[model samples]
Target: MTLKTAQNIAKQFTLVKAAATTLLALALSATVMMQAASGASRVKDIADFEGIRENILVGYGLVVGLNGTGDSLNNSPFTEQSLEAMLERLGVNTRDTDLKTDNVAAVVVTATLPAFARQGTKVDVTISSIGDAESLLGGTLVVTPLMAADGEVYAVAQGSITVAGFAAGGEAASITKGVPTAGRIANGAIVERELGFDLATLTSLRISLRNPDLTTSRRIAKAINDFIGNRVAKSTDPSTVVLNLDGSKRDDMVDLLTDIEQLMVEPDQIARVVIDEQSGIIVIGKDVKVDTVAIAQGNLTVRITETPQVSQPSPFAEQGQTVVVPRTDIQVTEDGDKKLTVLNSGVRLQELVDGLNALGIGPRDMISILQAIKAAGALQAEIELM
Candidate 1:
């Protein structure tokens, strides 16, 4: 059915009513597999293409052009030194005189040169102040050499910085938003060299798991071995699966990788419930199965409140006499008693949500409930908290 039809039906009939009288009873619903219900996923969704990756490059540079919000003269010596050297390069006489600069800041620029990027390619660069600078708005970066991890200059960065924010006023009173000292310039750097890789010489391929699982690794190895009709894949660990296409022709190996990647294998992750206490987030993996157990969750909240009051002197006692006082109060409340919920044998996903909802606990409360269950050996799943 189309989404519009489903929405109309959902609007007319509540999910609970439909579940009891119509939804699950429909034969069509049995054939449809929903991703949310089961964590069954595609191979391509979790594995990366073997030889594809990005290269990181960094460079040191200077940002100029600020009315007075730039680095302070006495604090940032690098700013003063850079300004003097720049003047000398232009044939302008720069002497032993002390320099005071409030329009420049020393910064480190960085960018990720993507795989297969050609020469003269314009890539974005991020500039972060290595020195004290109030803001980088309207600053222009001088040409600076961008180096890779090997210490080779692969690109040169030079552009007018486009700061998306600003800072104003003096030390006493200032209004600022965004990162004043750091900013990004789009298409700011030009790539001068290219990275090379030997694709033809590749004999073995690797399948790296996004989230490692012993069961999933075994399944991946079995799937590849089945497709290639030989023992072509081996699991180095839970995360790495190596595919050795030895004795196979180069053309045949290319075809082999294409078929192996498309082979569908059910990835198995350990049953787990993840919680983010700060955001009150709950994630339940498909394999999460709870043992038959009973649970009750409750919460108590205590709040303190303060109200200020003013006391004035009685008539003619002391005309200007006054005192400050506060009226303090406290409130305590215990939430409603939660009835014990029993987990049936082989409980399903819907049963889990329904059982939790019966307790009338919010996401934050549910986190504590799951934690208690895990501690009691009732929850047969890993409990992760952030």
Candidate 2:
């Protein structure tokens, strides 16, 4: 072949290869865009398996080792009584004497016991002062038995308190950051008892959605059923999906739950607009729609000026007297620059925002306008006031 023909063939091959690569990249991009538009999320992110939850435990405790910042025993009689009781427990009888301790504070200790927590596992605890304590900055929490709602002691918490705030003051003023009366202790409690729950022995399970929606619940059940290749999952309501473990091929319920939780499904939500009147915050959902409506916003302002003048009698006449006279001026004005803006029917969130922006109104005014629109039966979405 001629050299020129050979070069032309090579150049053609290079162009063809570049075109193929561009086509492949475009195909991948389209696939990614489609997946993103589907809005699929893992089942674990949207639903929780039944019988798997945390339990709250609370207890009354005492915090000591404070530098004169603890509760005043004179003002807080419970503190004084508690000090005497604790001393009596330790073989030192203080019931006959007045307990004047400023380094002891009564506190409420709280902690959450996680599901399936072992006896030796540790959890964090929060200590909050229940009395007039100035600070818990350098205090240590005493041993406290944390109890669950069943009135049974579940865990024991004790550690040095970690206060995130501090207080400083002279005679005149004081400055405090965060909450000086509350503190946290990391990994301060050890579980003493295990909850009576057996996951492997359960024959059925219920999956509860974080946000209740019929479509989303059905989608989750369908995803679980399709993954197991059986009719094991069913949606009974908008908030719950039941799973029959007997029909499942897997014998281990743990493995079955692990597999089901990893499956991805798209969740659905209703169209609603959330408005916070206090903060002037407005949130428009993606599915929110609006009917055709005309919106106009304006404010009328009135200004008044007052000036007082003293009038003197003509050139000190015998019977003349000085008197005070009042002059007033008033001006009334209306917003003429604001005009009515019309929104088309079936307008989406973006179009609605654009139309509202065209009216040149602040969020406060827009809040009122949204309420007015809802009252007029023009907004298609539910209005939620916060």
Candidate 3:
């Protein structure tokens, strides 16, 4: 062959090789992305701190200062009792005399002590009338001991409740906003006792999942195991992830939490449909994918259009009084279009949202769709209506 033809053939061979290499690279990249997506589970996305939880503290106290709207002196005997008790504590002994009060309300004060609350720290308290009180506005709570479930006093709540609502006027007419029977006392309760558990006491740490799943738990265990040489984390249950701690491994628990929280373990969660009936709020998770199924969305529209027609007695009638003739009309429109989203592979949350949005449905409609999906065995999460 001629040298020139040989050169041309060599160049063609080089071009073909480059093309093949480019195709192979694209396939490899796509495969890696698919593998990563498959590894992502719903369990590892959210976490619940182990050994760290909120404690509910509650107390009973008297609310003073209401203009006849407080508990009835005759009906609510507890109010009188509370008043008498308060007076007795103040060195005034009138226990034998019958007492009536219209300026007091027996109320239950509640507060949540957040984890890591220190001694003497103040937290807000919620005051709700426990008696036949009309309003708790402008009432001062006397010294009340806030106790935990164990019956140990954790704090003392005392302050005038800042009721956001109020009732005014007599029996016939009254104006009120927010909630008159309930109010919040900002920073009213002082923490007296700290939590009993000492997290720093040489022991093993735990990584808890807010929503637990076996696949997610196993993935988390593997991720942590891979992050470090030792198997520091283990799944005791779907909700619990235990981490063995060595005193020499970490110094500050706070720092350790910071690290663990940032550790990106894809979470796994049971497929669930959650709905807030009052608010019409619905949320679908990314893992909420469906098997091969068909869904139909429809809209039923009721239109009531008023065509006001004024009628006058016949042109030559004596009264010729003009009157409005009610021409109320009603029509219903149905959506004959049905769009379906084929969730062949695992779909992400954004995709699910987009699919639902394409249905051209409202909050209530979406809620119905979710319910139907769950019923049809297409939706893979728990459905909870709140």
Give the root-mean-square deviation of each candidate in angstroms: 11.5, 6.0, 11.1
Candidate number with greatest lDDT: 2
Q: Candidate 3 residues 1-386, lDDT tens each?
A: 99999999999999999999999999978866775676643222476766688999998888887777788878888778888888999999978787676888899999999898999899999999988898887778889999999999999999988877877767788677778999898999999999867776636777777666787777777776665567777888887778776532766666556656655466556666679978998866556776555667877899999999998888787876998999999999988886775655456567677777877788988888778877887776778888
Candidate ranking under TM-score, highest first, comes to 2, 1, 3
Q: What TM-score, computed on C-alpha atoms, does each candidate reach?
A: 0.76, 0.87, 0.70
Q: Which stretches of candidate 1 lie above 4 Å from their native place?
A: 1-42, 82-95, 169-174, 247-260, 301-332
By summed lDDT, the worst window of 10 consecutive residues in model 1 runs over 27-36
C-alpha lDDT (0 to 100) for residue 193 of candidate 1: 91
C-alpha lDDT of residue 158 in model 2: 97
Local error of candidate 1 at residue 55 (angstroms)? 2.1
Error of 2 at 382 (Å): 1.6
**How many clashes in each candidate?**
0, 0, 17
Sort all candidates by lDDT, best to worst: 2, 1, 3
Whole-model lDDT per candidate = 0.81, 0.93, 0.79
lDDT of 1 by residue, 307-332 (tens): 98998888888457788899989999
lDDT, candidate 1, equals 0.81
lDDT at residue 240 of model 1 (Cα atoms): 83
Model 2, runs deviating above 4 Å: 1-33, 305-331
Candidate 2 whole-model C-alpha lDDT, 0 to 1: 0.93
